[model samples]
Target: MRTSPFGRTALSFGFFLLPLFCRGSHSARNQTANVTLDASFVVVEEYAFGIQGVWVQHREPTNCTQSPEKPRTRDITPAQCNRTCFPGSFQPPRLSDCNKIIESLLNNNTGSLQANPHTWVYVYYESCVAVFENPDEDSPTLQYNWAVLGANVKSLVNSCLSTPDQNSIGGACVFDEYDGKQLSNVEVAVQRFTDFDDDHDDDE
Candidate 1:
């Protein structure tokens, strides 16, 4: 999704235009990415929910060249990455920050897993996100947002919502447990998609 020069220039002028996540209940409208502008800068409604993030891909690597007398390496240096986002796709914010954060999360023993295009990254600051009915207190309703620069991250999102996947991945990562871990397997994912409502928060 390459942004037109006009779009980039416009979004850049208002890059900090963050959106708001709904308070009190589960408003999928809270899942919207709204943008306008104040007299001086662009304005965007930020949501810990929509902007919370998932992954660039979910497919596993199909091949790995073996190392002589050693276990094959899991190094995921972007230069050596086998898969990539569609040409011209522009992840929001900065792709550099996403790479750094995702790379940090992919280090052996820590971080989430990345099987080629199926790269996984974690939510930052998250003072802006939420889980269930609770919103982060530090970041208010909006602040920072994390973006993945690739394909469908629905399964990854579900992993984050699920129990053991994220826990198994980053149970000891840090104090920010939920954001750091994967959101798959969550019991409350809306398979029967419908209008957002207060009751939705407790569907799980």
Candidate 2:
């Protein structure tokens, strides 16, 4: 049986995290009293049946013996985890609407939205609709060439916030992020919830 790209990525990630997990376990064992570790956040890429989507996992803190061997993770709902969770204040784009857009793109049924034959699109939580040029035939591998589509982000958020009916939002929008550069891999683009500071001046 062939391993899917998603499986391969997960296996690799697991291997990369083995040492960290070991260290965490060791530390837990040595603690005199039960110690609670900080919660971890990750953006997971899920691909199955040739369809890809992203979701956020908020791993709750673990207290050595009180918690199970594996830390518990809570899958954050799109509504709860959005731009509002970040430092900068902005109305977050509705993830349900973004899901519709991704579905349309995957089914090749985008009505007004035109994506290049060589481009692939997916949503990065409530942040933005990420677009990337399909890797060349020579590469044939899906590279992490994704970049945020500013125009699409604006349109989607505006539509979701202003329009009462979400059913009409997906097909009516246009997607154009061809010139976008400074791409990053979807896997490494994980958002850290613990890194935000109340006094920080930077805005998203």
> TM-score of the candidate numbered 2?
0.21
- Candidate 1 residue lDDT tens string, 132-171: 1111121111111122211112222233323422321111
Score residue 52 of candidate 2 by CA lDDT.
38
Where does model 2 exceed 4 Å of error? 1-121, 126-148, 169-204
RMSD of each: 19.9, 18.1
Per-residue lDDT over 71-186 for candidate 2, one digit per residue giving the tens place of the 0 to 100 score: 32211111111221111123333455354434434443212222221123233333323332221112122322112233333444454433544322121122122233221221
TM-score result, candidate 1: 0.18
Measured on C-alpha atoms, candidate 2 has an lDDT of 0.26
- For each candidate, the alpha-carbon lDDT, in order, equals 0.21, 0.26
Model 1 poorest 10 in a row by lDDT: 126-135
Task: State model 1's lDDT.
Answer: 0.21
